[model samples]
Target: MHIVFVFRYHIFFYTRCSIPFFTNDTFETQGRRHEVFVNKTIPMVVEGDDMSAYSQCEIYKTSLNTSYSALNMPPSNTSTEQCNKWVYDSSVLKDTFITQANLVCKRVIARANANMIYFSGKMTGALVLGLLSDRFGRKKVLIISTLMHVGGAFGSAFATDYIFFVAMRFIIGVSCTGMYSSSFVLGMELVIPSKRVAASYMLDMAWCVGLYILCFLAFVTRSWDMILLVMASLTVLLFVCLWIIPESPRWLKSKGRFIEANAVILKWETINGKKALTDTSSSKNTKDDIEPESVLKMCTIPNLLIRTLLIYLNWFVIIMVNFGISLNVGNMDGDLFVNFAIISSMEMLAYTFCFLLLNKTGRKRLLVGTLFFCGGACILSVFVMLFFDKSLYWITLVLSYIGKFGITASHSIIYVWSAELFPTKVRNSGIGTSSVVGFAGSMTSPYISDLGKYVHGSFGEVLPQVIFGACSVIAGMTSLLLPETNGKALPETVFDAVQFGKKKADDRNSRLNCFYTNDAFNKDELTGEV
Candidate 1:
């Protein structure tokens, strides 16, 4: 079953059972253990710039709370009626236009590629940025790619016609691919050991927040072109970030720039109030504290190849379900944008809950549990739509939402798991390739979503459900073949990867070595070694 986290204002109600906000504080007569920190200020996430091996990235901010609260409006005092009108009417709500726009863009772009016009400039852009970040640094890549994304967003926004708009969207896709991939890689390298998985999942959470932010922006704005213009204007943030962002010292050290990397680590410690490790150190406080193995070329290893395949398939699953449910909503009688926003908010909540349980539950249980429920939910949805009366649209919708909830959790698992699966050498390349495969799946979604529009057969809904259901089951089953990475140090090479799941007594690798981490540049105090 999909576990929904309903956070209380210290008061939890499980739909039926209500638990009051009971805390055992210092002054408690009953000697309860709860202490309320209401109105207490949490430390702000240090928002600034840093360069990783490939490029200089300026992190905007970070949060530890992965709960639905991340998507929540911080107790805004706005009246409900006032907020509703703006939310519905705003330009930010125009994300609904994207599906239509992207479809139009896809049709146009397909033609150019067919004529051998080298249409996949986005892939080229992605590769170039990947290498650029690797060679020049992650910080520079951040600045440049953000501009590329902004430019693409603007061009797509103001596209005069289908052809032009499609072309701009293509450009936008390329830039976004570059920015998204580069940012993900850099952000992982920036946080402490324990914070990694949560932070990684937060990337998607940020996407959700982006939608809400767009919602707010859309409310305040009017013109679609103006929205694009505003989006473009948001890129100007890169310039401001240049001052505060630090160069990726680890990347510098990886590229044989240790002195600079050391300086950067010192700066990180100064800002975060943690002790910096001497060059090449790591702590072992928890399993998460264990460092990642080095990256190796993806094509060179057998397990690496299999893992890549798994990652790509999972991504395809995500695209299939994400767009399928979303496009499914458009066929109904509702404000499509609001519905999509609600779905996005729900996805954010899924990510948040996953964050809380990820460490405790481990990856295997979560993946399996989510997938099994996802398949069941899809199957249930079909029956609801078939045997039930028209009055049950609400029920069918709930089932679909449940399926979405499952797929969203599965989708998140794919990204972080892929990262963990790869060695440092080919980590980016592996993910990059997986992304292309995922995009191939993504590119096909519109067509898949359109299948039922004019068709008479059950192929539209039934086929998709069957396919998704089968995929979910198969994907979950495949996870069993993979080893439990929980608390285990990442292996640096294919040899180590192959040997990872062997019996305890058969262990050749000490499981305690530095393996594949940037130990000298680490600041994970939890591990204590660093």
Candidate 2:
């Protein structure tokens, strides 16, 4: 059930980012004409420059008879006027909101603004829905979010007005955050600690599958509205499946609903063909009187503050770099669909590798390694693009994929690592807060990617890549301060989280003391023997 929900949610959530690429069309000034009757004072041989023939934003008032000494010369006695109409090339894209609403030239910023608006909605949902899930139950929020998601998707599909479409996208973004965060927390809580790494990998694989499905859907439909309608229709099945899924037992226990928690566990055991313990004694051991901690406690507590800040930074960097690279698919020199599909496949491989190494290498070490690897790839790709010839463009693509692989692995690890770091009492809230910060990273990525277009020459091409790579490196170094969470039980309370790393620190100190003592004794024994 969790797998189905994740798979469908990703399809709905990620498709928005890819829509702009299909909808974007090359356009030229409308009603452009040359006056043939104007007198030419001088005659010269001319060569036509097709590239400079037409303006995208402005129309030039000039005569075809204007005198020019050479080809590619600016039209003499010409005045510029802002074009009110445009003729979009519909050869590639049959129809799009950009063409329909005329979002070209000066209005092009609206496209990036729309993406930012959606991410802002995601930020809001992370905070509000995350808190709601912790205060209410994950199941209730998940159900509500599913309905919201479907409604928003349908709204987006049928929207005629550009503003209306943007609004629907925002709603979809908000609902997607709610659905993902609630479902992820619920899924994590349902499983035992030992199996969490595997479960996380499974969820990530589901996401990859959704990406593949999206690529196919986009290819088949070729229309953004049709694609949305199909995906929304398919997502309805997840809502139906949610009816049979149970709430998190861990959440029930955290809220002091031991009877409910035990009931859920007993059902699981019965389904697995094991004898269920009828004893209520285990419930009595827990302190039902203890109140669940709020996310604010993480900020106030000295022990948790640094950890929380560090995790937030990691979340920000991972999301920024990941989305930054993913959104650049359209700008890459190749088939857009093929590039997206290849990147999705790379993500699947990364998840597989991460699953295999997670336990052996531990979370912190693996995360740091992947981040550093991604950063190195991103930085190297820039140099390749700048210094190397165009013939080596394929090498740049390979390096970009390498960066994708590293970030994909890091993305998988962070989800499991952050979940284990936060206590059950405020786990949803903690993740939600981190997600809020992460969404900000995503919000900025579209503009960062647009930097390539605003800047000229090779430097413009590699500027975004350089920024992403630098951030990844900085994040990797900062992550070194985070404690390893592999093989550790999920922290259950604020107190438990506060003490999470203390035992390891103590053990290390003890080992050092023993080593020094043994050395001193060996030195005395050697002196006596002499």
Give the clash count for model 2: 0
Q: Once model 1 is optimally superposed onto the true structure by TM-score, how far is the C-alpha of residue 37 displaced, in angstroms? A: 68
Q: Candidate 2, which segments miss by more than 4 Å at Cα?
A: 1-53, 62-76, 276-289, 452-461, 504-530
Candidate 1 C-alpha lDDT tens digits along 1-530: 00000000001101110112323222112222221121111111232123211001111122354221332322322222100000111222333232223322124344334212112445555556666666577788778777766776667656656567656666666667677777777666565546667677878887777666655554555345555666677766756766787765545544555567677878877887977655533232223323233333444567656765666777667656665665455444455446556776778877887888777887778888888888888787777767787687787777777888888887777767766665443445556666666656544555655556555465565656766677778878877666665545544344445555556434355543223443522444223632
lDDT per residue (tens digit) for residues 140-227 in model 2: 9999889988888888779889799889888888888899889888888776555677888888888888888877877776666677
Error of 1 at 83 (Å): 41
CA displacement after TM-score superposition, residue 405 of candidate 1 (Å): 1.8
Q: How high is the lDDT of residue 19 in model 2? A: 12
Weakest 10 consecutive residues of candidate 1 by summed lDDT:
1-10
| True-structure RMSD, every candidate | 20.7, 10.2
Residue pairs with backbone atoms closer than 3 Å in model 2 (clashes): none
